[model samples]
Target: MSPSLTFRPPTTDDAALLLAWRRLPEIAAQSFSDVPDDIDRQRAWIERSNARADYVHRIIQVDGVDVGYGSITVTHAEWRIGTIGVYMGDRRGRTGIGALNFAPMLNHCFHTLGLRKLVNQIFDSNPRVLKGQALLGYRHVGVLKDHALKDGTPRDVHLFEMRAADWAAVRHRFGLFRDMDANVTG
Candidate 1:
């Protein structure tokens, strides 16, 4: 069966699923916060993020099933700069679906939102994320050593970026933005 992926903004209805996904041990380990077991905290977080104009939280769906989340935050400045992050729920990992979800998200950020640059920071240990980012036209900008303390140990983070011009130039190499007209019509 051919599988299709899509993304939509998160809503109150997705709070439980998001909480569940976040609760997975592997997912929590890579995230900023340990997944909260309390529903109230999850609801509060959702409410706060939903109210913020600068934050966007989206649910990624594969074959109409919610499988992951993608977020982008616009940096405050005259220039159009933003940072993006993605997390696939435990069950969705290693399935090569993350990129499918990421494609439209990138398109939306650059084309629909008019952003000039998008940045991604991946933990040095997570080569899977690094590969996914590279597949999406992000170039390795640099590495921040001992940047984050995960599980009480310092970890480095590799910074990757794709400028609007860079994306336009190398997008075809990745086949992500290739056949744009066909993707839009289908």
Candidate 2:
């Protein structure tokens, strides 16, 4: 069976773990913040942001061990759309945790939130993420030229989006949710 994947509301106790992950050189380089260490500020940010009517700040747990972070920000809710942000902070490469975490998040965005569309902003430097998103059916909408600076160099950021109907048709057709569905049957 595919490993169980779940997301829980991040608590203040998770602040340190989040800070450590965020400070990692690889993680920091991809972040817009560009700060090496900001524990105090990070803690405050965590406490201030929690489960709410329109947003969810979650700690990604794979088989119950914290492995990453995720966020769903609802925008134009009345119109049914939101933005999803996720990262595998603990980089155990090729683990397939991304697919596990992603399937549910994408499902949640469309089914639970009743969102018609979803969008993600990613750094061009992070081609791996971009490629994965594309494979999972996100379309390149556009790019903002020199929108973000990384390591003192200008980097382009790209925008990607997916519609709920499009995703539903592919959820199983393209094997996006095949593994998860297998678990359900077997």
- TM-scores across all candidates? 0.85, 0.83
Query: Which clashing pairs does model 2 show?
Result: none
Tell me the whole-model lDDT of each prediction, alpha carbons only.
0.74, 0.74
Local error of candidate 1 at residue 97 (angstroms): 3.0
lDDT of 2 at 26: 72
Candidate 2, residue 142: lDDT: 95
Candidate 2 residues lying further than 4 Å off, grouped into runs, are 173-186
lDDT by residue (102-154, candidate 2, tens digit) is 77677767776678999888988888888988878889999999998877888
RMSD of each: 3.3, 3.8
| Model 1, span 63-169: residue lDDT tens | 77878887878885468889887788846533855466666666666766678898877888888788878777889999999999987999898999998877677
